[model samples]
Target: MALLYNHLRDARIEWNRHQPQGGETEDEAEARAAAYNEKRRLKTVQSSRKSNKLNMRKKVAQKMVKLCFAKKDEEGVAAWTWFLKLLTELGNAGMSSEESEVGDMPTNSGALASVVVFAIRRCPWRLAMVNKYMEQIDEAALVVLTSGHSKHARVRTEQESEKFPPSGLPRAMYNPAWLTVQKTFLPDIEEILNFSEGSFTMMEVEVVIPGVN
Candidate 1:
């Protein structure tokens, strides 16, 4: 994950002032051309690295959920705790408190929602011990967190196409596992479900209309 951040931040340091200018000597123009090409190359690299970072987050979330399914309780808690720490560091480094008001970067709300969903479903008892830190989540993130509990709950992915497909999503309602999870978590799945009256209209659009992003 740190490696992914390193690749994302690489763009910030490699910026060079190399735009073509009028009345330049042949040698200077050649140097500028090379630098400009390097700039384009760096842009492509940064784009690929950004995709890698988002993909890594999905994989990490999936792995943590998988560990919970395997009933590796202790390992699940440890992995979840570590992942939360990583996200905190990433958010702070990318958008510090003082600068976030002026920044355009998206919040980690979706990622937090997905991670919390799996934690509530797979390891509520274990989560209770470590989730005190969740109180620090900002109001914007909290909104998205509760949004998933709504009936119109939509599963949004960071990538339209991923190399690794998701598996073992949380159980649907009325299933034994679903009931168990609902019983353990607060707010009653029933009350949360009552909050939303509409269904997710975009759920099947990906398959119905490919390349629509």
Candidate 2:
């Protein structure tokens, strides 16, 4: 849970931690250091090996360039175009320690709709974007994001699709957003996760629209 100190416009964070009391003399600490070094030498070598592999992964990501574009009202062509560019940047940073939080409407797309409404009422772009897009989306090319928890065994099932008939099983949350979706077809909630984004997580969503609209 998160709380906001409205007056300060800041969020208060709570977490559990263990505190350490310090009272070690320099000589006492030095004596332990020598023994620690002997044990740490091999561990350091192994850690470096892991770091090397991560570096290689980063290099591999640099070569991948998947560009997906969403068309908005002609006025928002640029914003839609920018969204695709942003995805490419995120792909490049795949090796970094950035974590995304995705939310699903498993409990109720209505609840998800409520959150969307709240966001739109407070900041309306594609005010009714989700419902609107889901009403018309293609499920075939849809990407899915599943829960990280093992309750579902880390698999994102296709439960039911709203987009098109063929879709990927659940994976993990990607990013969702309010798009200038036209009324054509509907995709399953799971299949359309990649189409939206609230900082790269499926659960956390953000819908965009033209500034003037």
Candidate 3:
């Protein structure tokens, strides 16, 4: 919502700035734009409210709901609301290690991975979600933060070769795995990791370890 409102406000200011100060019918054009904006804004809110109801429903496999846009309407507002709503739910749910998410899959940069861990390895990732991980997680009481949000998240290994350009993505997993995505309120986020320009790769995450050290 904040993102959406900011964009709308910016667009309006730019529109007004272009008007002829004393030109004939200047006020009328401004009024028309304002009215049109209001209607669209209202619609955007309505869509968000509808999605909120859907978000509250608890489903293991169906965590996030995807929103669509009309051909001519701006999509930022709807996207903003959808993300904010996801964040609200995410903060409350303890993150799981067996899940993960990747943004715009076949895309580059600006991609984000939200790692939810109950324990911060003062060391490196153990390469697997162990039973020990589960135990620590339950006692750890975790919270996730992201520029974007989602429901189910998973862990993945990306081991890439230097010759290939992607050095972190694993060439292959010995164990049969359901590659997962580390989700955030918005998969679209700041370049938290310079992992890869496109394709998949391993990204680092900082977790607050559980218990009094």
Candidate 4:
């Protein structure tokens, strides 16, 4: 009899846990349940965001592989166009890394180090293009730095505009001021240019260290 009474008491307690409390009206019970569900929903969203952050490096690496290894020609208009596209993608990927960091955004130095390491792994041969793109970024960053505004139309005269190549795309399309993953990883950019196509294996080991970012 005691065991059956205890079982009944436990079942009653379990039922009451989900039911409205002694003084709670139907409206009050509904509001309380809604608040709890909202909290659970917010927690789910936060968990998903954290998961995305953890996967960022893997995602960026895969994208770099796709960009670097495709069968595009190595010279002329096709190559130039492909190279430009690759640069834009690299900058975008780096920007994504920055977005993960949120409140305390990393400096270009740290973020660039991480991205340069990633770039070298996926596409060492075209890594040299980083220098050219960096120059374009420097031009754009200069304009923004000096002017105190974000507008892009300040490139004065026709002669002065000659700094950007006629055949090339705009600095905005290429360097994109927000891409701190680095338009150019400064220290290694010149060194990367010196790597012979076959010599990258040894040089990569020396230059691409882990965890710099």
Report model 1's TM-score to 2 decimal places. 0.28
TM-score of every candidate: 0.28, 0.19, 0.21, 0.25
The CA lDDT at 30 in model 3 is 75
Tell me model 1's lDDT, rounded to 2 decimals.
0.35
lDDT of candidates 1 onward, in order = 0.35, 0.29, 0.33, 0.35
Q: What lDDT tens digits, residue by residue, belong to model 4 across residues 140-186?
A: 33322333323222211212111211112233233333223333554
Cα lDDT tens digits, model 3, 1-213, are: 999999999998877754655564877667766777787876565445335423432221122112122222234334333334333332222122121224333214766554442221211222343223333332322231122334332233343211111123232211113222322432532233222343322222222231322
Q: After superposition, how far is residue 7 of candidate 1 from its true place, in Å?
A: 29
What candidate 3 gets wrong by more than 4 Å, as runs, is: 1-13, 17-24, 59-213
Worst 10 residues of 1 by lDDT: 201-210
Question: What's model 3's TM-score?
Answer: 0.21
- What digit string (tens of lDDT, one per residue) describes model 1 on residues 115-155? 21101112222122222222222211323233322222222
TM-score of 4: 0.25
* Residue 6 in model 3: lDDT: 100
Q: Each candidate: how many clashes?
A: 0, 25, 24, 0
lDDT for position 102 in model 1: 23
Two-way TM-score contest, 1 vs 2, winner: 1
Residue lDDT tens for model 2, 112-198: 421111011111212233223221111111221122211211222323222221122122212234222322234444545333333
Best by TM-score: 1
